[model samples]
Target chain A: MGNAFKEESTELAKKTAPADLMIVAKGLTKKYDDFTAVDGIDFQVKRGESFGLLGPNGAGKSTTMKMIGATSLRTGGELTILGKDPNKQGPEIRAHLGVVPQTDNHDNDLKAWENLYIYGRYFGLGRKFLKKKVEELLDFAQLQDKRDVKVDQLSGGMKRRLTIARGLVNEPEILMLDEPTTGLDPQARHILWDRLFRLKEEGVTLVITTHYMDEAEQLCDRLIVMDKGKIMAEGAPADLIKKYSSKEVLEVRFGSSKNAEAAEKLKHLGDRIETLPDRILFYAEDGEKVLKQIHKLGFEPATSLVRRSSLEDVFLRLTGRTLVE
Target chain B: MSLINASIDSAIAIAERRSGKFGAEFYAGRTNAILERAFLAFKTSSWMIVLSGFVEPVFYLLSFGFGLGALIGGVTDGAGNSVSYAAYIAPALLATSAMNGAIYDSTWNVFFKMHFGKLYQTMLATSLGTLDVALGEIGWALLRGLAYAMGFMVIMAPLGLIPSWWGILAIPGAVLVAFGFASIGMGITSYLKNFQQMNWVNFFMLPMFLFSGTFYPLSIYPDWLRMIIEALPLWQAIQLERDLTLGTVGWSTLAHVAYFAVMIVGGLYFTTKRLSALFLR
Candidate 1:
């Protein structure tokens, strides 16, 4: 824990001095009638960086994204995008920002090409300019063959891609996506990720909010873990894994009811332990050593395995709940 | 006075400043784009549905003004005198048609786009403000109203309904009437939480249609009831059409114009305010 903390703080110190920043939030808070949705959280996003907000469903990630998108006003605190106050300069700032909301809100009544053209028109683009731009966007979204197709006829993945294409109509500098692959199949998720990867390569700054740990691990350069509207930790995925979780975890099942009993005895064998309905987990530097210890203690399990730690383990350690449960 | 002025100021600020750099031309184009979007998306079958709307009021005009005209004789006018049955009810049918076309587009269509289609949210994500949406949608409603008004006029001559050259103004007059109904209808829809709440629209519309002097004279109702019904925008619509088709132009025409002007401005103002509260929160 000490060495991991040292590594994370040093990494944070380096990132704090980023040369160019596209977004900055200071003590940002959002309050509703009964409770706080975002509790004075702080973060910074540098230019051309792939940043993430990782948390459970009600972690205020969407609320924070709304504030940064300049659509929802901040109840308190300050937010700046492209070096302008979002509250006072929402339109000016949003002119350079692209937002893919949690759901695809594309114009379902229009054809694919018409959706792109009309969305670009909202930015006051000329018909001649949009004629060329729409073709380019249709090609970019891989919908050139489906240009005249109505939006309701497209598959879920195609709808998402068209929506992303519409977001890029203005050639925005910062692209913010909320749960970009929430409902997609595995293959479609990969294709969308590839598209996002290409956008990052093109020097577009990306701000993403997702609950998928592998998504955070694969895409984000830096992320802040949030729970109950507050920051739990902040670092790169690997750094967060090293800081909040052990190097490995051992899983053993002693059926259902006895798993808790086994956990009572197995608690002393590892650095930390977590128990579930069907399995017991031992967090340790060496998973093999923990398994051996469990065997030596004369505990027979239904099944046992040893694996390396992942962001899931870190999430569990920090929030005490699985990411997808 | 200041409140209306302030809302107008903020609304204009959203239109001119928040919409972008191209100024008035850009604003016009964006609003037109929404109408254009609908145009591009409409299928032949949908056009059939729009054409069918024109047929309904004609049926009413035929049933009430032509078929029942002999039995009903002349209707009592505001001045307590009998007027031609066909002429008296022609203006009423015109007013109801405008009301139906405008309210249908603004309420059911707007609700569908807002809740199910998720269309406005997407547009609002861009530089489009509440004003662009308001004007664009109401503009489309007015276009429909214009078509109906013209068709109503062409048919009015055959029915022995046209009485004066001032009847030409009813073309623009239909637009004004639609603007008032459509704007207020959209304002009410923005506050709605679900489809069930839409029944209130029917509740208000049914009474306004029946009692706004669209059919019988206001003399059937008591004095207090007439006063209440007279203040409604549809009543003003009916009265304006009656005066124009009768060639009874007078100074009070300006007062009728002012009533609808207030309705148009006030309805549009509340629409923008309510939309901002709904989408920009």
Candidate 2:
């Protein structure tokens, strides 16, 4: 714990002094009636960092993001965007921060391109500049094919992309996305992630919230795992896995529920044992060695597999719960 | 001077100076955007606009002018001036339609944009302040009210309800009435949480439309009730439009116009403050 504090403060100091610290939140908090949605927390994101908030449902990630976006007022603490207080300078702060909300609330009355055009105009952009910016953003979000269509007529993915494009109309310095790929298919999710990566490479700061551990692993330079309005753990994906879990995980499934109970009796052979409804997960440095020992115990499980431990394992270890729960 | 008084005086000076520039440039920009959107909505939904704004006024004209006017012929106005029932009621319907259209757009449409559509949220995320949004929305309401008034005027031209060429100026007068109501409605909308509360606007607007000299002149009312009705904003607007359209202009006409002017300025001040607190805070 002492070492962790030292490292965290050092990181915080480095973040505070960076020339491009676009977003900063200090001891931020939010409460709705009796329930505290976001507990006191502090963090910073540099200009080009792809930061993430990884947690399951009801984890306060959305509340934290909304506060930074200047849409939700903070109950306590200080928050700054581009070195301006959001309380007094909300319009100015928001002018530099692009936000894609959790849900697609595109104007049904406007066409796909008009959504971008009108939003640009609201930012006080001239008509000629907004027209050109709308075209460029449509191409960037890959919504050029659906530019003229009414928002209500477009598919879900198309609408989501157009909303993302609309946020960029002001040419914001920081971009925040809440659950960007929550309901997308595998192909669509990969495409969206690819676009986000391209944005990251262009030196745009990104702050994203998601429950998908693999997504955090793929996209985040650093992330915080939140639970019940508090930060449980924070680190880079690789470092978190190394600190909380073993290098490999072994999965053993018995032929019947009765057999699975028998296999659990031999859990002392692994570093950590987790019993699921049908399978038993064994965390160990050498999954193959642990599997051989289990085989020698005459368990003869129905199925067996071995794979490297992932951020899912780290999340489960830190929160004492699975991500899917 | 004390610091507090000094700050207050400086604030007032800034407001006075900025009001002139912001009022014209900002409202012009906002009014332009709102007019564009209203036109686009009308272009796509022309039938709805025609049915609501045009047909509804005509229906009111037929029902109250010929049907109800027969029972209440040659009513005396507040100034004890006798006029034909149709002439008295025509301007009232004109004012009522303007108020109804403006209030409907400012409250229902603005509420939807604020809550469900999240349109204002998106707009505020840009450089547009809360004042810009309020001005834009009220400007749109005024434009819609202007269109309805113009259409009503054309219909009245052939009916001989229009008494003189000066009646042409009543269209813009009706728009000022709409702007006052629309600005007040925007302020009321910022306080509302759901669609259920909006019915209260009708509670106020409907009574004002019916008893505020819309059908018969206020002289028909008891003295106390007439005084109260005369103080209502729509009553003032209707009185002005009636005098202008019926060629009965007098010094009281300036007071009627001043009433709407006060409502416009005071309503806009409160509405912008409320909107800024609601959206920007």
Q: Best candidate per DockQ, number?
A: 1
Worst 10 residues of 2 chain A by lDDT: A1-10
lDDT tens string, model 1, B1-281?
01011222232233335332333211333588677777766652376778877888888888888789889888766555567788898887888889889999999999998889877777767766667788888888888889998898899977668677888887788778888999899998988878889888888898888779887788778899989988888888999888787777787777888888998999988997787677777
Model 2, which residues run further than 4 Å from truth? A1-18, A253-264, A276-279, A300-302, B1-42, B67-72, B164-166, B190-200, B247-255, B269-281
TM-score of 1: 0.90
Docking class of 2: incorrect
lDDT of 2 by residue, B1-281 (tens): 11011222221222223222323212323335545555555555647655677678789889889898888788776557777788778888888888888888888888888888887767665545566777777887787788899999999989888876778888998998898888888888888998679888888987888888787656668898888887888888888888788877889988888888888888888887886566544
| Residue A217 C-alpha lDDT in model 1 | 92
Give the poorly placed runs of model 1, Cα more than 4 Å off: A1-19, B1-29, B43-45, B75-83
DockQ of each: 0.25, 0.21
TM-score for candidate 2 (chain B): 0.84
Q: How is the predicted docking of candidate 1 categorized under the CAPRI scheme?
A: acceptable
